[model samples]
Target: MTFWALIILTALVTAVFLGFSLLRGRDTREPAAAYDLRVYREQLAGVDKDLARGVIGEADAERVRTEISRRILAADAQMQAQTAQAGPPVWVTITGIALVGAFLVGGAAWMYNLMGAAGLPDQPLSLRLEQAEILRAERPNQAEAEAAATPAPLPELDESYASLLNQLRETVAARPDDLQGHILLAQHEANAGNFPAAYKAQQRVIELSGDQVPADAYSHLAEMMILSARGYVSPEAEEALRQALQRDPRHGPALYYLGQMMVQVGRPDIGYRIWTDALRNAPAGAPWADAILAQLDELAFRAGVFNAPEIPAPAISGPSQDDIDAAAALPPEERQEMIRGMVNQLSDRLATEGGAPEDWARLIAALGVLGEGQRAIDIKNEAMEVFAGNAEALEIIDAAAYQAGIAQ
Candidate 1:
């Protein structure tokens, strides 16, 4: 990462290349191990001389020479096979090498220029962290410590966020045709947990997109829908997500948030299905993938589906079944049944309490896990009815449910 460090790394790598070159230069040649025909001729001459002096018969001498030559040819063929050159490079490999070199040099120079712009001397991680801790201690209370423990709650950003929202609104009010202004205002509202205002902005954007070339408008609205869904899943948010996917089904944010919204509206089965679908849609190593995986893990654990039916037990090298008469008498199937019963009690105990939102979401998720999709839809409709009075919340749930393909 540092210049000196990179220099050392490069030198070490170059040395490695040199070492490999040396190894390759070694006489993999098999030492011309096959005796030369000329040498064989010399041996034959010596043999003839020995025959003349009564050391060996002609038959034995010829047999010895022939055997040596045969072995030599076989060994030579094997040695040649070992030293043969591999085929030409693949296009992909060549392209990868080119990309790597370009990025390495370009990234280093770009990084150096950018860091120079920073201008400030960097502090060590420990010193920086210590300073942070001291500054935190200097504050009136343990707000910093609590924030570190959880996701720091949305900052007390009301004034600043409100100004940004108002500015965006005024821009929209003046132009009315400013789709971007509406999108920005909606995003700001969602950030401030004002789902109603955000939904309204997004709805207007959708209408605008219908009348003109949206150019990523659906995706823009979907992001706000997702943000709003996190705090409240209502019809408006759901519809927003539907519009997003109708435009681009693989819109990553919409896929993930819609998956979550499905869980909130008493359609866990549909939620689980949607979430699993999202896992395929999202890029690897992203937060959406992680969230889906975590949800899947918890769901599987809860449903008593974590164990594999065909898992092989580790083998005991020195096994003797003679000692455990009672245990050995039990059938494997019956033993597994007992284990399931024991695990059920433990799982129930672990099912303590999550907040109401989590509970509703989990219920929806469970339906998905159980593969009872129709049941999940029925649940959504029921919840939708109950949520009707809360227009903003109902709007999100309805939108989520609709996008999830659950019946209203």
Candidate 2:
């Protein structure tokens, strides 16, 4: 009954719209035919007024009046000719409107009957849900299926690193309750590009930490899962990301990955919103910030949003490899001072400009190589805090710290 009522109402509205349009088309106001004659008549009055005021002599006024009068006669004749040929016959208009109305109403009804379920009953919510369930069951998750069919390859490892990994696994097996050990193992495995092992290690980290686990731990687990699957966000990975965000609402990596997941699931608008906010809040030159900025224009276009947030990143300057090489030729004392100076410059820039994960790693390594182990440890702690939820970056920086002998 409601459907029929809607159809009837739509028909009435369409009819009213057509009626109003037709009435407007039949406007009675004639076009301006003797416009030039009226203009000339006004000018003639102005000329008379000017003559009474002695603005022009009578002879000049007479000449202007004659020219104006001739123009007026020509315009009047044109007006009469236009009036004779003015409007289409009223019957033709009525016939055309009838045909148009018939096409609009009859064509719409015909199309509905032919293509739509015109006679069928309305689908209820429960029926729609059942249909959706069937469709979903019939369709497998393409990303998961594809990933399962073709697993991602692990990076090749050197003998020493592989031996170290074996030893680490044995240690974890020996002392399964060591939360820090599990965290370290996860970071090492991730740095080695063994994401499946990294995922399992991070799971162990979560289990060891229990309810007190940090947001980055969960985010790290999610990252490992995604990496393991070659960037597919599986259901388990999605849940991990949710847990990360629940722990820390502004978790940058979680937001970045969630935006990616949203785009994969065909919600580019949501993805664009998530990424835009992430970009705004992300540290300048941070890996995620760079990634977000690089893809933002395409995302905005895809999402049909005209305005994406424009955040400016400050310029960052650091010592080049050539500078370091050149400094090696100086005397020991000069070299120490020069390296210290360079490190200080980098540290100051990062403190003010907000640099990338690699920059932080570089600073940490420089400090450690300079025999400032305590400083390296402090910077590592700060980098971990700042780059929370950025598992890839943290893993890389952790490796740099290990190389620099930043305390276990």
Output the number of the lDDT-best candidate. Answer: 2
Top candidate (TM-score)? 2
The window of 10 residues in a row where model 2 has the poorest summed lDDT is: 321-330
Query: Each model's TM-score, in the order given?
Result: 0.32, 0.50
Cα lDDT, model 1, residue 289: 63
Q: What would the per-residue lDDT of candidate 2 be over residues 1-408, giving only the tens digit for each residue?
A: 565557656875786688667666667545464567778999999999999999999999999999999998888887777745356677876786677677766776677777878668878867855664564344334356445746667678767657656766787778888765676578668867878788898998789786898788899899888877777666678789999999998888899888887776666778899998887787655556666777889989988887877776533536543345434443466456646866898999888877777788878877765778988999899899999999998997898799678757
> In the order shown, what is each candidate's alpha-carbon RMSD?
25.2, 13.1
Q: CA lDDT, every prediction?
A: 0.51, 0.75
